[model samples]
Target: MPVFNNKDITLHYATFGDKDKPALLFSNSLGTSYQMWQPQIDVLQNAYFIICYDTRGHGQSSAPKGPYSIEQLGQDVIDLLEHLDINKAFFCGISMGGMTGQWLAINHPERFHHLMLCNTAAKIGNEAAWLERAQLVRAQGLKPIADTAASRWFTPSFIENNPAVIKQLSDTLAAGSPEGYASCCEALAKADTREQLKNIEVAITVLAGEQDPITTVSDGQYMVDRIANARLATIDASHISNIEQTQVFNQLIQQYLV
Candidate 1:
């Protein structure tokens, strides 16, 4: 267990590449852990100092109760970077991770060299809905959501063609702690980055999935329009755009990183 103390929590993380190179940090979506970004790690490891970690509670990390704010999550990332003594990095996050990236840009501008946010929104769902999700997940395990999870995470074709991958992902969730999953959902439901987005003056690239049912393209466009130097790139995949279309997504990210 590669763990680092973040004061409030101990984070279970996976680190790759080397310290001398530019760093790339990836954040996964809700109900998912850093393992969700393993594919990206495989691709980016050679060129960047890659950091991927399970948020407190979800994967191999310790789980706490009740609620956690997005700012706290962003701060955790900063703490991790400080733990490693990384001055700057290339940050990319999907969905909840994207929100974290936005928060980081607002409060910890010096931590990143470049930013890429995919399948994310400035304001996630309202608080009531998020709290409800947390409550339900606490009552039931992740299995109940497995079949329907794809509706929000991946398109039909991707799910149908990649049964093995989907099964593995579903299994990952099925085994996840209900408390941890629900707590993150609560964090998302109450998270609204709209007011704070103006504070993010860093250059950013927003990647939206055209077929994404969760955070639609409009959400991505909104971020692009709001953030001063932010640009939007729309892909044909669903919420997990990078997974569905890695070739195009990876190439675009590489171009943006350059």
Candidate 2:
């Protein structure tokens, strides 16, 4: 329930484990909240101080206006770190969060020990598509997106077997703020770090979903090829690998953080 204000925005964040432990920051994807990281937290809390926060337009965070930038999303993390008085941490982010991690690594390399980009790409879908999606959400609300999210987020088998999980995530997206979601869609529309990938000095581990149709394994490979000190790991889940392949994802986290 802890919250912090960064200028005009208020971000909701939660912490686990001991402050004395190494800090591990978790940033959620476009439509999800900090709670999306629960599976990882349940396993890793004893070893690290985990920090999970909702992005500006997601979760309990304040949704300001429209057309947010990747820089704004990245700066929010820096502000959160400053608010918590943490100088350095291991960062993990998925999809849009991964995009934010790229911006952070390129712009604020001094603030992180390592970064894990999961089920994401340096440049996601085209600008026109993102803009169109933003417009669609703004016009029709989140139901349209939420209705089709499962197919993008999980494989058919996982969705069919995990009905409750799918419902929770879908419902969360459906209930999310329309302006906030659209604003972030606008941010993603302009977020392209392909040219800037080579500039990232901080160590990075890109986790790709083998079954992910949104951000493919090739996207993860592209990042690893450009980054100075980066590697790639592939998981057998779709876009939301952490939820679909929890044990394997948790294992990878522990492996990299060590």
Candidate 2 lDDT over residue span 33-86, tens digit each: 999999999999999999999999999999999789999999999999999999
Question: What digit string (tens of lDDT, one per residue) describes model 1 on residues 2-28?
Answer: 899777788998889887878888888
Q: Provide the overall lDDT of each model, using Cα atoms, as 2-decimal numbers.
A: 0.84, 0.96
Model 2, residue 175: distance off in Å is 0.2
State each model's C-alpha RMSD to the native.
1.2, 0.6
Candidate 2 weakest lDDT stretch, 10 residues: 1-10
Q: How close is candidate 1 to the true structure, as a TM-score?
A: 0.96
Q: What's the lDDT for residue 147 in model 2?
A: 97
